[model samples]
Target: MTTGPGAGTTVELVKLTKAYGATVAVNAIDLRIAAGSYCCLLGPSGCGKTSTLRMIAGHEDVSTGDLLIGDRVVNDEPPAARGTAMMFQSYALFPHLDCVDNVAFSLKMKGVPVEERRRKAREMLDLVDMGKYAARLPAQLSGGQQQRVALARALITRPGVLLLDEPLSALDPFLRDRMREELKRLHRELGITFIHVTHSQTEAMALADLVVVMNQGRIEQAGPPRELFNRPHTAFVARFIGGHNVIRSADGLRAVRADRVQLGGGDLRTDGTVRALEYHGTSVHLSLDVAGADDFAVIVDEARFYDAPLAIGAPVQIGWNHADAHPLAS
Candidate 1:
């Protein structure tokens, strides 16, 4: 009953597994991406996030289990037959073709007339704010501009699900941030499902409504970004997400946010020596070497740290509220 690219199809993977001979890449993972939501599959290399995305896009055949789009099974469907479009990390725009023509290529393949497909392609270009450069070849545009053209090409299919494979990884920091915002805006406007794969936690945290963390071809945790960040259920989740310190307490292993750690005094206190100090423009991160734990960290306001700097090797007592601590599995 949904319309436009916003048809908002739900993608479900039930006991999905992808194997190559003796090796297993995706090991019986089950995931349900809700209709119209932005989901990010986050992990380091070889974690199977890319494999999972490719399988969803029909680029890779599922080794086992059911892959569903909406109510129907799409495991045997071709990439174009599935209501999904993938924008690769490389952009993959045609160098010889102009912007509009590149976007219109898919429509041309479908046997649409040149004039109609070009018009539709231009409409897509305008949606991504690249309409004015419709005649420019991929060589004439910047990296971000070419990415936009590629995005338009993908959206022209009016796909229910748009898969992005590290789409911003190739861009510089500034353009990456800019394109990240553009992607969020496009998702909002189109109301379609976006399954983005990235190794960068910052990108996932900034863009996703749901974050799926994977390790060694398994999902470590999957939840809202704030939930996973604030209440990581495992040490792996805490460590991999960053900004959290995994420490052992009397109750057992637990994770606490670095920013919640009070350096001076509170109900729960621990003593450690300052081993490293990193100053960001807004805050200072003090890495502490506790005797019984791995590197623990605390983030203090920049002004507070500069007012009374803690010298390296200085023994410091850090404390936090008991309520701020969350228990973690071994």
Candidate 2:
């Protein structure tokens, strides 16, 4: 009923584990990344996102568990031998090689003839809309261009799994958005599995067909973007992904979403004073102080805000149906 990135078989992680002596880099976990799927390992820094990605790419040795590439175990294979191409966070483009040569580096290493490698690289560059910049060196290209070259280089190898480590973190907002669309298009065109790692919630929401939520070396939740947003499984996820106020209930035993409360209700339901209202073009965010409950905020339409505005001194009542509140039990 839902989908995110690519379409194919599946990439299964069977009890994957990675540890650095006493420090657990990745706890025992199981995951199945759908084939041709664009899955992002999303979490804060030090959560072992890169470690999990590296294990899949064979950059880091697995402590235990099986990694299956389309139903075949790949735990013992080398990165290249495992049929995966990794685009590192640093871009990792060769400084001396021009864009074309850099993009063709892998093919050339694989014994692809000069002419064939050059032609393929040029085709890839054109696919990335960087054909005109083929002759430019890494120093000559902008940051975004360099990143694209890194991507093209990875794709030139035609590997089964494409491992992207925070690929868009360096680009500005505009370029990041454009590149997100480009990545989606490339995934559609190539039909290869994409496993991306990113800490940015916006990027994960925009780019992932499936999101693998990680924290402190463990998976928190994994699901489609909409499902994760609309029905987060834990308090950490609710607060981390944004756009929702997790409020503690009156008895201090539960947290509820602020937007779930009906503003036109008989009382806005427990007495609270308006603290502040932050207005965006389309919506107004209300900061409230509810007695007997933790502080919270609610989002209302800008039109609604204007039609019935509440001042800072105004007392408000807010409550939602029990069924509308999701219990964060994870």
- The TM-score leader among the candidates is 1
Report the lDDT of model 1 for residue 316: 91
lDDT of 1 by residue, 152-241 (tens): 999888899999999999999999999999999999999999999999999999999999999888899999999999989889889999
lDDT value for model 2: 0.83
TM-score of each: 0.96, 0.92
How many backbone collisions does model 1 have? 0
Give the best candidate by lDDT: 1
Question: Compared to the true structure, candidate 2 yields what TM-score?
Answer: 0.92
Candidate 2 lDDT by residue in tens digits, 1-330: 012224343678888999999999889888988788889999999898999999998899999988888767989987777778899998999999999999999888889999999999999899888999999999998888998889899887777788999999899899999899989889888788899999998999998899989999999999999898888888788777876656565433344555666675632256678989888888888888876545577877889778988898798766667666766764
Error of 1 at 134 (Å): 1.5
User: Which sections of candidate 1 miss by over 4 Å?
Assistant: 1-5
Q: What is the TM-score of candidate 1? A: 0.96
